[model samples]
Target: MFSVIMYHHINSDDLPLSNSDTMMDAHLAYISDHFTTLFPGDPITPGSICLTFDDAYYDFYHYVFPLLKKYNLKAILAVPSAYILEDTEIAPEQRLSLKHHEIYDGDNYKTYAPFCTYTELREMIQSTHVVIASHSMHHVNLSEDSVDLEQEIFGSKVVLEEKLGYRIESFVLPYGKYNNAAVALAREHYSYVFRIGNALNPSWEGIGGLIYRVKGDGLKTADELFNPFKQMGYWFKTMIKMLKGSR
Candidate 1:
């Protein structure tokens, strides 16, 4: 089956600062040992998987890149371009507001460290093992009606495409939040849109519309790494939970 696994920060701290470096490596190792690592041009549903990182965390550039290089696997990075170079041009008041309120580099405090800088993102892009996509301009949640969803969707795509000089066709919903309007807006601008869930593979509906993604947090455990039965069991549990929640 085809799947897109979502990841965030990659770090060693277990104090729960949103770091996943420890788990990410374990997940990659599992994939390397059991499954054939596939890139963007891969065909799935007959058994193919795609690895994706979200939020453009600095830890990803620092910690995740080395592993990708070692495994020779390409992963998609969904980044917000607006906050990349916050030091320059971004107003001081705005910067302070972001630093104080926004979460950056897995830190919840009032620090001003962007997940990664433009240079770092560019460097990652230079590698054949990485593809950068748009998360959004402000990484704002599309579920909110406060901001025009279309503007958020279209503007972010334009900025990313212009800044990176690459066709930004894929988008990930911030906070895994969205609705029909958000979906329609996204469809207008992006070829694919990923939502957060814990399913094993892309549903037939997901493929026909945009795209769907499942979280890869279980990747931390190395005990039954790459075991099909274990993976299926995990997915089964997750689907059951989702179904229960819906009921």
Candidate 2:
């Protein structure tokens, strides 16, 4: 079974959405010891692990990037196109004040915690260890019918490709909320789509377009995540969710 771990902020601050750099390093070490790290397009195998970061936070560039290089592993970075296009810088104090989810919600996020810059992204991509994928154009919840599907869904792909000069084949659904319409729209654009949830993705079937990922915030330590009993709990939760037809 393969697992896709989801992460948000990787900062030293005590924020609700952040995991300390030390803790992140521990998680990476544990995964390196226990599983083969894989990227978006790589064939999923038993004990395969994929690390994905959401929101394209600057801290990912500040903390996660170097650690990933040190561990000699690859990760998928889900970026909102507007955040990169805006290219604003985040203040130290503001990083402590705002929740990670709030970073994509309002104008304050634009004024406060900045997303990764294009220059930084270029440098990171050159490393050949990072796979850039679309989070959305403005991080809007796509489940709403009033949403501009064409813009948020398709437009973001266009913007990222144009700016990054690469074919973005993967996308992550925002807030882990999606309707049938949203999924259909995403499937039309991306080869793979990721959702926030816990499940063991089996490799018997080729890696499907819709993928489920576990919440990384709940994992405070490597032991908390790697424990076999805890893993069974994750599987049980995923099974219940699937039975409810949620994922």
Candidate 3:
């Protein structure tokens, strides 16, 4: 079955949503050996897999990009446009608030890591193995009534295209929460909109709506994914969920 795997941070340190570089290497190696890695716009084939990274962490520049180059794989990066833009330009107070919270490593807590800069993003995109997509303007939950749906959904797309000088055809739902309104808004702006979940989509159909993604952040090794029984069990549960029509 085809799978779209989602990753957040790639680092050696043990932190929230962090996966080690070693484990990432293993995952890539296993995927390369077993599946056809596909890009966002590519026609999905049997046993195809797509890799995606959320949050546009700086660690992805340092850790993930090089490995992608080594493995000759392509991935989509979902970037929160506001974070890439000057923090002062948006909600300065909220930026300060988020910065105050630190991430805990295995031994000690440290200041939260920074997101990738524009230069870094350009470098990655130039590599031709990375596709940049919108995560949102501020990474807010689109389900909330208080949210400005136009700004969060369409605004991010405009910003990324303007700043990066290219059209962004894909989007990932922030927090994986969305309502009918949110879905409609996303459809107006992007060719693909992804959600956090575990299931495989028909590659030939393309991702025009809510595409499910399997979480890769918690995995410690490739073996966990390569096991046939585990793979079947995972798909079996997904099948049950699908039959129930549950998200």
RMSD of each: 5.6, 3.0, 5.8
Scored by lDDT, the top model is: 2
Model 2: per-residue Cα lDDT over 174-193, one tens digit each? 98888888888988989888
Clashing pairs in 1: 10-21, 11-21, 58-115
Instruction: Give a tens-digit lDDT track for model 3, residues 1-247.
Output: 5778888876534455667778888888888777888777687667788989998866787788998899898899999887663321323222222321332222111133366667778888999989998999988899999999999999999988888888898999988999889989988888888898766665523344567787788685675755777678668866775676654
- Model 2 steric clash pairs: none
Computed on alpha carbons, the lDDT of every model, listed in order, comes to 0.65, 0.78, 0.75
lDDT of 1 by residue, 85-109 (tens): 5323433333333321245445432
Candidates, ranked, TM-score: 2, 3, 1
TM-score of each: 0.76, 0.86, 0.83
The collision pairs in model 3 are none
- At residue 147, give the lDDT of candidate 2: 90
TM-score of 3: 0.83
- Model 2 alpha-carbon miss at residue 154, Å: 0.9
